[model samples]
Target: MSVPTVDLLALCTTIKAWGRELGFAELRITDVDLQHAESGLQAWLDAGHHGQMDYMAAHGLKRARPNELVPGTLRVISARMDYLPRDTATDWRARETARLADPAAAVISVYARGRDYHKVLRARLQQLADRIAAEIGEFGYRVFTDSAPVMEVELGNRAGLGWRGKHTLLLSREAGSMFFLGELFIDLPLPVDAPVSTHCGACTACIDICPTQAILGPYRLDARRCISYLTIELKGSIPLELRALIGNRIYGCDDCQTVCPWNKFAQRAVLPDFDARHGLGSADLVTLFGWTEAQFDQIMAGSPIRRIGHERWLRNVAVGLGNALRAAPSEALVAALQTRIDHPSALVREHVLWALAEATERS
Candidate 1:
């Protein structure tokens, strides 16, 4: 179907205005070409950096060629939402570092502290699309948020959202790396924005602070060793070598971001949706580990953490508990882990046994 005729420049202006109204912190349009990122992606996959995310390799070059992946994808309307929770303290980075030192604290990635962003982004993007449709009648477009094979970060960079930081995350000088990215592939030929110059000169703070050395080099991340991928993506035994380095981060790791100089400028969410929920921002390992399977489901029903399921939940908390034992051994910590000693999933049981042993060794 032919795309409805619209004044392209005026439309771009309206789209950006609509995006801000929809709570997106920033939005820009880019053509559907991602040839620049294709080779780097292929090399990362070849090096097995994607770990068990076979889908990264399975998609082939189709991922870079959005025009082919989704026919009639003339322009990608990229959007970034600042995800630092609304109530985040001004000294949030130092506060997070303090959490890491508190052995009993349960550190979830800031992004997952609230409602699942996949749902939030898709709904908001669809609203933007609907508003556009209202302005120009029927149109061809599909909204995506961390969905499928979309090269979201590349599109965001090309659209002038921000440069991909050395840690491989999109970083804005104004907003830092505390944000989520989404895309709208549309048939409209929107005027594209100019790409921004990278400002990560001679700064390896992100790489230097990585607990697992996941950042093999500037702009190259080995997901296999990344704590986030280990705790959330890998659905098997937590690799013993990296378990202790995982620290008390049970869901995702923000060490790289917290340490980045640019993140000092990270912006807070305009919408309250990204605010920390259920006191997850302040939860402790023993307290989190003590939740029963039913309690886990009930509390985590609308959370991104729920996607990891009860078994993985126990597994991650167990790793945290074990690390906590070495940091601050207590009868309370050991007893909390003991309650899950006979968990039905061997994954959970083994981690619990390991946690118990960690406490015993400390004693």
Candidate 2:
């Protein structure tokens, strides 16, 4: 039995509609020729800008060649979902600024406080692809969300969803940059979207505001020195020199994104899955430090924070505590450091001891 081929234009239209129905903010498609992007990617890798994330180098040119990584891929459908928390009080950048100064405050990146975006985006993208498959009758496809080896930002830009910002994140006039990106690679040859013009003209807010100077140039990031990369992606002991610059950002940092003037236009997520849970958006360092391993698991389940596990969580919290101690050394801070003095994980205890010494020095 032959499955009649579906019209490519019709399929693209249907996929876009289905994506909207499934809660994606925008959907765009592009052909798989990333020749223009290859040089930038090669340069980034050659400079070791990826830090300890060797997979970026290991994938080599395959990162830019979608069809090579996913055989028979002809079109890539890129989708964006806005993730700003709704019904917030004052500006988030102001809050993050306060957290940086307080030291006793725990600052998790705004994106990681809610449910894991990987799970949220993958499920929605799969459902969108499944709906297309039902109509087209068994098309070859693969869905990806923050998955390895896919040049997602490049694909999103090529698909006309947005242009890559100076910080290397995809940004749109309509969507700003507070969003998650996902991809659906299909064998069907869909019409490609035209790229949009760059709007980050002469804007160095993200570059200048980065505490670690991670944004080396316009659209170039040295992930090795990025706080987000240092705290979350770099699995080993964080380099001692970078620890103080990390400030109170325990899990991930949002300094660059928070300072972007374009982010004022950032949209709130339509899906409830992204709403902040466990009061994480406003949690204090001491409160989070008081959590037992079981409490940590219970509180962080379904959140991206779970991936770092308890040891790293404590290690991060210790850094925040250390900063807090320096900012306002107190008996409470001393007790917290002492409680974790003999923590089971050497990594946790090491950071705690360093934090205690820092607190003592401040006193």
Candidate 3:
């Protein structure tokens, strides 16, 4: 057997350039070893901070060890793609705040409003990998985007992509936390980039603005209290204690990112894939709650929001309606909850009843 030689130094330069051409905001290389992240991962699982996201702990140490996850892995090509729409207005953050205040408007996460990023990033990353293979003559590589056991934030942090913010998401001085991270694990011995130093300083804007106080402290998050987990991840019932605090957030919540001071510099996506679809950015709560399972499946055909399915989707919207009712009782909001009171899913029916109760008590 003959050893295939590679010019690693030049390969690193070529890979980054190709990544930029592939619509990635930035790309950096890092070694596969994640020994530094293992303890933190274990500690989080130990504390049960992951809630019902059993997948987070299911992969065990493979989540921290890329070499174990994909044998023979040497380097991880971490790529960042900013997800904000290219046409996002300058006052977008203010607009988000205003929407939240409206009580009747449904607030889906900006990221989920677009095409499923998993589909977009995975396909693009595969292209990036194939392009590398074409240049380097076949390489051992597997691309991942928010998939499997890989710890993307740690990889992105070590690859000099960004520092992990107080809310436990990667935030770049140039890109904030509004970006998708993908990794191309390869056996090539590419030169590694130095990690970016933490710049969160004493600023606690993200923590202060967290609707559920999901951020226990800097770099510490309790996902159980997180609205995103309650709405999207938890399958059974939402804890009643946190329902009111969830407010009008029907999908994922972005209060932390929206309030972050560094987010002023957040970059918009180079590709149009993330542009808000179906008017999700300004959708009314009653409107989203009225979506039949078929309507949800059809309209969210290519959206990440569909992952929660119409059942959880209704559950979340019901919570938002409950909050809206308490904020100010309205016949439209009450009527919407009544329509779902007999929903086929027990979970949806349970939430619908609660939403109606909120209106009853408040009125």
What local distance difference test score does each model get? 0.91, 0.87, 0.91
**Runs off by more than 4 Å, candidate 3:** 1-3
Best to worst by lDDT, what's the order? Answer: 1, 3, 2
Model 1 regions lying over 4 Å from their true place = none
Q: In candidate 2, how many Å is residue 305 off? A: 0.9
Candidate 2 residue-wise lDDT at 16? 89
- Estimate the TM-score of every prediction: 0.98, 0.96, 0.98
* Top lDDT model: 1
lDDT tens readout by residue for model 3, 243-337 = 99999999989999999888899899999899999898889999988888899999999999888899999999999999999998899888889
lDDT of 1 by residue, 1-363 (tens): 786777989999999999999999889999988898889988988899998988887879888999988898899999999999988999999999999999989999999999999999999999999999999999899988987888888898999999999999999989999999999999888889999999999999999999999999999999999999998899999888899899999999999999999999999999888899999999998888888889999999789999989899999999999999988888888889888888889999998998888878868
Candidate 3 has a TM-score of 0.98
What is the alpha-carbon lDDT for the whole of candidate 3?
0.91
lDDT value for model 2: 0.87
